[model samples]
Target chain A: MKGAEIFVQSLLREGVDTIFGHPGGAILPINDALYDSPIRHILTRHEQGAVHMAEGYARATGRPGVVLVTSGPGGTNVVTGLTNAFMDSTPIVVFTGQVPTPVIGNDAFQEADIVGITRSCTKHNYLVKDVRDLARIIKEAFYIARTGRPGPVLVDIPKDVSMSECEFVYPESVHLRGYKPTIVGHAGQIRRAAEMIAQAQRPVIYAGGGVIHAGASEELRTLAELTVIPVTCTLMGLGGFPGVHELWLGMLGMHGTVAANMAMNDADLVIAIGARFDDRVTGNLEEFCVGAKFIHIDIDPSSIGKNVRVDLPIVGDAKHCLQRLLQELRSIDKDWKAAHADWLAQIAAWQAKYPLRYHQEPEGELLPQFVCEQIYEVTQGEAIITTEVGQHQMWAAQYYHFMRPRQFITSGGLGTMGFGFPAAIGAQVAYPDALVIDIAGDGSFQMTMQELATAVQYDLPVIVAILNNHSLGMVRQWQQFFYGGRYADSSLEVSPDYVKLAEAFGAVGLRATRPEEVRPVLEKAIRLRRPTVIDFVVKTDENVFPMIPAGGSIKDMLLA
Target chain B: MPTANDEIQRHIFGLLVENKVGVLGRITGLFSARGFNIDCLSVAETEDPTVSRITLVTAGDSRILEQVQKQLNKLIDVIKVMDLSEEPHIARELVLIKVNAGAETREEVFRIASIFRGKIVDVTPKTYTLEVTGDEDKIRAVINLLKPLGIREMVRTGTIAIARGQRVL
Candidate 1:
């Protein structure tokens, strides 16, 4: 068998049914091989779209999403998507074609050092030197991507390697000395952690994206119920704890809710579960948690004490460690309550005082929060919700009542600006049956706006709700708050007509300015059985409240 | 931060560079071009056909030291840069240590190292080598404590470290 054929065969063995990619000269051999292969390749208009589609697919289904692209710009285009996958911890395998081995460093046509370009972003990468390494490298790439802290892996294959003949032998077992995953928790450490949890007076659980990635939501729910400790999540940790649950305190960060932030600040003992204390979460590190004794439990050992110093660090899987803690806490101490009456009461007052309110005196524009709530109510947290970065992304994280883990997929860590539309395409492709919505801002929607063609060509019914305010509203909001209302390059006045853009890409477009028009249009889009974009002309000057001012504590929130 | 009396140690590394356009730039650019501190680097043709060797060295710890090898291997032109520390065979270093004395304590200083089997490689009537060998750590410790006693001049042959057991780079 030829090397390209062998690569295809290995993918089939791994049960990869769909691949998103764009064609180019360097990858003609692989594309030629793909023509006869059983695997279906969805041609995206842009290489960036292909990667996002793969990301969406991976998030929707619990499988590694795959993408393929040609050399130079095609390879470079996948960078943003790879970075997004890296930040969000999504499993994606990106295959990029390189120039022929004979002319690799000769400044060959359509040639770029993809492996070097994507080194920092990718979990791991391989540049196939020979045809014999093809099957083994592809297999290893998949294994690396799907295993421990799942992220994107890149495999750059030279055109010669793709065209060369080789025996198809996919490795059943691959070993790398440097890469070792610690699956089980150390017994002694677990016992010490449990002891610390038991001794705490006022304890709070801070969960992160790892909880969802580990598929430990049920364990988290059980643990929260058993302990009666309030659980707050990071941006990546949304949907890990059902938002409607009494124990859940919603997302905690710069724009986190009042109660969640209060719970974090007030607690004497903070049990950080599978979360790295990102700068966004810990606004001012010095005054963060005055007297809280931290017990950080994470699978990646390097994460512990890397950000927040831990008194007792437990490096292990969240589910396993939680289960061990449960076993250790057989004897109950429900009567031993550390006093948080004053603090909890204050938080309750805040919740009651500054609850998210929409315009009662309607100026005719549909409130973003209402749209998010209605979507959540209609979908009942069953459909996967992906979002572009900005106000809408934060609002979705805040308002959507996500019941299942991995249901709310948005760019969290890197906060890549234009991740929504193509990511939604990927999500729909991953979950062909479920209704997927790409909740995006007007500005973010225009960035990767070319992905509309991918959705239409693939017949992926991804409902994109463009929360259009006709500006780069997130920056504008920030400018209004911190930059003396000097709106510097935040306007989207020269944006292409989105309606015509969607139509041009062969998708239906709906516009909604009023509250009455939103639900009906959304319903129509959901029922249309084709790709649809809903332009929500929300209040132009609307801001995401409860923002932690620059270098300010979460306590210094500006509540609306 | 090197002391005024302390000398800098330079180690030479042989790298096999592939014959490709910008390969040299990719290799050297990794040093001067980026933040990685490179003391001294010299590249030239090697014995093997279609290959060139790059000699460079830096100082750090043995703990998590494999990263140096791994990162270098990732570069397209760099075939390998083996630390000569792994090669067996006794290697010698030339060091000049100048101790402080005013004739009263000068003989006392010369008396101490002679009994410990150290030779006075160079002398200015107020200083001597007490030439010794082991590794950088052993050399550094003696130099540090001696500085309080008065060290005027110091020179170390960087380090040409070789492995104890039989091995070749």
Candidate 2:
């Protein structure tokens, strides 16, 4: 059998049902092999779109997303997506085609050193020089991508290797001597953590994307309820705990709620489960949680003390560690609710005093917050929400009450614009009947608007809800406060009519200019049951409040 | 006895890694990407053909040093990382120095080389190439003594370290 045939066979063995990619000259052999295979291929408008779609698929399904692109430009286009996945710890395997082996160094047409280019951004990468190593390399790539701290991996295959014939032998299991992940927590550390939790008078649970990645939401919820600890999530951590739970403190970061930030500031102990203390979350590291003793639980040992020092660090899978922690906590005969009564009351007071608020008159210009609220209302908080990076993204996080893991997928770490549309398309492909909405900004939507064609071609019923503010809202907000309001190059005044663009792509388009029209347009779009774009003309200068200035203490927030 | 986290110190590390293509690049790339300073680095194939040993010298505060070790271990190509500086370890580096040892300076240079137990690898009408091996301090001392004699050129291998006891890395 041919090496390309072996590649397909290996993917089948890995249980890859769908792949996202764009074909080019160097990958012709693999594309030909794919013609006879049963694997579904969603041809994206660009390689970057393909990779983002793969990430969406991976995040939604808890499986590694797959991408196959050709050489040079195709390979380079996926670099942004790879970095995004690497930063967010998304599992994606990208296969880029190389020029024939003989002309690899001679710079033949469309040849690229993609492996070298993506070395720093990818978790791991390979350049397969021989057909014999093709099967094994694919197996290893998939293994490295989906295990440990999940991340993006790339495998570059020379065109000749795909053409060369070989006997296909898919390995049963991968054995990487250098790669071993600790899945079980140390017994002694778990016991110590439990004791610390029981002894603390005021404690807060800070969760991040790692909780969702490890599928530890149920364990985290059980532990939180058992101890009556207030749970706060990062932007990437939304939906890891029920948004409507009594102890939920919204998100805890730059634009976090007043209750969450205050709880973090005043707590005596902080239980960080599968969360990295990112700079966005821990403003002014010198002053962040200065009075709190920390217990950090994560699968990656390196992430434990990378930012803030921790008293106890548990290195294991979040699910396994939380299970052991629950067992240890259950063995104790303490009344956690009684002990934490005062602390809970203090948090409740804070929440009641300064809740998430925005003003909307009876007949005022449509607000982005109002649009997000209507989206939540129309979907009944059940829609899978993806967002581009900006003020609109924060509004969605604030207004949409996500109640399950993998429901709120957004670019948190990398903050890549134009990530939502493709990601929503990927999620829609995974669950065709489910409602997947991309709450996008006008500027961000324009970044990858070409993916509309891809959605139409596949008939994916995904909604692109564009908050058409006619400016890069986040940068504008920053300039308004810090840069003397010099909005240079931040205005998207010469933007295309999104409705026309959607119609050109053979999808339905709707417009909601007034606040009252927001719900009706969303309702109509959902009823269309196909690719629909809603142009929500919103307040141009709206800013996300309760924000701590970069490098400022969380206690000092600009709340208006 | 540096007690504070801000006290910067030099540390020698021994790493066992896979003997595969781009393994060295991966290690060095990680160092550069993470902004960890590498004082010196050396690598060679070990007794096991499938594995290679790397000796890296770096200077950082306690926190930075801990992060360096942890980050190095996180790489897929690195098998194990040992901080040789934490234990009783022997470290050596080889240096080849060519000195302009014409008539008057020749005897002094030769005497200095002899005191350091260095071998005269090459000799010409006006130059002598001396080979020396020692720890960093000894290498620095020898170089300092030979500096006044108009040293022509020099090259030195980075440090390689191993534990003194039965423990192996």
Candidate 3:
């Protein structure tokens, strides 16, 4: 069989129903091979868009998303997306077309040392020098991407290798020499953690993106209720537990709710599941949750005590470890709600005192928070929401009370500016009937506005709610507090008319300049059932509040 | 130790990594990316062909040292990381120094080399290339003694380390 034919067949064997890619000089043969293939190919406007789409697909589904792009510029363009996936641990397989073997070092037209460029960003990568190794490498790449702390993996194929004829044999299983990830928790560690949880009077379940990735939301909810533990989540873990539950203490971190951060600081025990102690989530590591004894459960062995010291660490998949934790607790047989009523009352008081709130100011400026709140209400908190980074992202985290796992997708770790729109397109592709919206700031939306064309071309009904603040609100907010209001280059002076841009792509465009118009416009966009862009002219100086200043402890949060 | 703040301590680490292309780049680039310092580093293929042992000397207290070790383990190419500072280990370095003796200081240089258990690898009209092997402190002492002899050129292979007898990592 020809190499290109083998590539398509291998993808089919791996059950890859969709691929996001862009055409280029080196990858033309593979593109030709995909012509008659059953797989749906979404051609993105740029290589970066393709990778982000692939990432969105991966995060939504547990399966790895595939990408095909040419070498050099096309390969380099996917670096940011790869880094984003690496940090967030999304499973994606990027296949970059390389120059022929003889011309590899000679810098042929689209030649780039892709494996060299992406080495740091990818979990594993390959340059297939032989066609005989192509199928095996593809199988390995998928296995690496989707297993044990899932992440982006790259495979750079030389053009000649793709065109070379060889017998096609796909490996049924992969056995990587240096890679064996822990799948089951240590029984002793899980018992010890249960003992700690049983004895604690005030405990908090700090869930993260890993819970969603593991599809362990059921286990998480059961454990939280059984232990009578208040649940707070990292931004990445927003939908891992029901946000509107009585025990839910909103998103916890730098921009976390007052109730959540305070509860975290005051808790006697913190049960962290599937979340790393990233600095953003823990403002001052030395002073973060100093009063709490920690129980950390994660699949990555390295994340156990990387940031904050852990008392009991379980290295395994969240689902399996969480099940073990529940079993251990049951074996112990302790009534937690009977013991922690006062602690629950204190949390309730804090929540009531300063909930995630923003004034609508109906006749005045269209506050970004109000827009997010209206979206939450209109969608009944069921929409799969993705957000571009900055103020809009934080507001979405604050306002949208996500009730299910894998529904709140954003660039939590890398904080990529242009992630949400492409990610929303991927989510829309995966869940065609479900509402998929990208909550974007004007500054962030412009970073990947070209993706609107891709959404239009694919007929992806992904709604983009552009919170059209005139300046970079998040940076400007920091400048207001720390840098003495000297905005510097953070002020995004020249901006495109987003509604017109969407209209130009043969999509619906709407505007909401008033608080009252916010809901109606979102309703109109959501009803339009097309790739719609809503230009929400928001208050220029509206800042996301309840912020823990950089290097400041969560205890020292500045509430506005 | 309980009350005092974190003061600088020299740390040694042993890392086993995949012996393949770009392993060195990943390791070295990691240090530069994080603005970490490598006081000395050495790498060589181990008895196992698939893996290479890298010994790195860095100056930092416990917190920074722990951070660096964790970061190194995060790299996919790195197989295992061991902090040799906590273990009883033997460290060695080989340094070659060419000093301009000019026939006047030749005898004294030779005497210093003998005290340090060094060997003369090369000889020129006004120079003697003295080769020495020892741990960091002994190597530092030899260099100090050779300073007065007008050392012209010097090069040192960085530190390589292993656990003490009956200890394995």
Candidate 4:
């Protein structure tokens, strides 16, 4: 059998039902092999679109999404998308076709050092030179991409190797000489963490993307309730904790709420589970947790102290670690209340004081914040909301209350400008019944605005709310706030009208500039049940409130 | 003296593989299967056309090193592998650091960038993008120096290395 056939068969063993990709010359053999295979291949218009779609599929379905493209430009095109998925910890297996192995150094047509270009972005990658290793390599790639702290993995297959024939025996398990990720927790460390958690009065649980990947949300919720500790989630950790729950303090980061930050600052003990303390979360490293005892639990040992320092570190899967901690915490001290009544009241006061306010008109323009709240209300916080990175992303993260895990997907780590639209399409494909919306800024919407065709072609009903400010709002805001209002190249002065652009892509489009027009158009678009872009021309110079100025302390927030 | 659970002494590696197309894919695939993280990796071709040496610094045990050697050898185009942790190696990484600077802070950034011998890549009225290349420690030192100046954006191309020996990968 051919090497590509062996690779396909290995994917079958792993129960992968579908792959999204754009075909190319170097990967023709794999395409040929896929012809008769059980795996379904969804042809994307752009290689980057295919990758984003795969990422969306992975994020929504909790399965490793697969993509295949030709080498060179095809491979390079998927690099940014892979980097996006990598930063968000999405499990994606990307296969790129390469020039024939013998012609590798000849500088053949359409050949680029794809693997070299993508080394930093991928968790791991491989090139199957010999047919004998094809099945093993594919199996290993899927395993690495889906297990533990999941991320994108690339497999570069040479055209010659794909065509070469060899006996295929799919390995039952992978035995790599250099890699062994720890799965079990250290008993001693778990005991110490439990002891610390039991003793603390003002304990806070910091959840992250790891909680979702380990399928430990239930355990996390149980632990949080059993100990009466409040919970705060990272941007990627949005759906892990129910946003409306009394103990939930919402997503905490650069744009996190005052209550969440205050709660975090005042905590005596922080139980960090599956969450790495990104710089956005801990504004000042030294001031992050002055007197708090940190008990960090993560599967990847490297991540323990890579960012924030930990007092007692327990290395294991979040689920396993939580289970162990629960067992060790049987002797609970009921009389121990951290006596943070005053602090909790202060948090409540802060929440009420700066509750994501926007000028609302009863009969005027619908505020972007109000639109998000309406969507949240209509969808009942169940729909998945993906956003292109910018003002709209921050607004959605701030105003929208996501209640389920893997519901609010955005370009967090890489902060890619145009990730929302394609990602929403991908997410909708993964969850056909759930409502999916791409909350995008006017400038960021145009970056991948071409994907409207893909949505219309597939008949995917995705509502895209374009927060049109007629400029790169975030940069312009930065310019306004920091650069003495010197707006340089931050305006989208020249671009096709978005309503017309939507028509060009064969999708319904609506324009709502005022508050009264906002709900009517949005309600209509939602009812139309087809892909539509609601262009809402928001007020210019309307900065995202509660701004944490660059290098500005949390105390320096410009709350208006 | 190496117990099964010693603080896995991190090893920095510098690999010179064939500049051929799939060389990186093969080498990375090997390290990935063993779950070894290539913390800092940079790859560029030397004067030679038939070869491109990849500098990768990774943490692993003796078993991992052996596996890296064996699996790397299994690839057809991987010409050679050099563990820089064992030899005198020259390691470097480049970073494009953009800092939010006003009139007062701009001078501080310029001074630090000058001290580090970094070139100013892009300059706006409120921001200065500096491009600096050096070892991990140097990069960290530069970042530390600029911290007081307010780093607005930063991108590091991890670590790239070449062994200082008569032989080349």
Best lDDT among the predictions, by candidate number:
2
Two-chain DockQ for each candidate model: 0.07, 0.55, 0.28, 0.03
Of 1 and 3, the candidate ahead on TM-score is 3
Candidate 2 regions off by >4 Å? B1-3
lDDT of 4 by residue, B1-169 (tens): 2235435556766554667655666677667755777776677777887667676767766655544554454343555566667778787889999998799898888888899999998999999999999988899999998887888889998787666867554
Alpha-carbon deviation at B79 in model 3, angstroms: 2.9
lDDT accuracy of residue A222 in candidate 3: 94
What are the fnat scores of the candidates, in the order listed?
Answer: 0.00, 0.58, 0.18, 0.00
The alpha-carbon lDDT assigned to residue A497 of candidate 4 equals: 82
- Mind giving the per-residue lDDT tens digits that candidate 2 earns over A392-429? 99999999999999999899999999999999999998
Question: What docking tier does model 3 reach?
Answer: acceptable
Model 1 chain B scores worst on lDDT over the 10 consecutive residues at: B1-10
| Model 4 agreement with the true structure over A144-239: per-residue lDDT tens digits | 888767889999999989888999898889865345556788999888887887777677889998998888888888887777678889888888
Candidate 3's residue-wise lDDT over A10-119, tens digit each?
Answer: 99999999999998888888999999999999999988888888988888877898999988899999999999999999999999999988898897787788888887
- Off-target runs (Cα >4 Å) in candidate 1 are A331-350, B1-169
- Binned by DockQ into CAPRI classes (incorrect, acceptable, medium, high), candidate 2 is medium
Predict model 1's lDDT versus the native.
0.78
lDDT of 2 at A267: 93
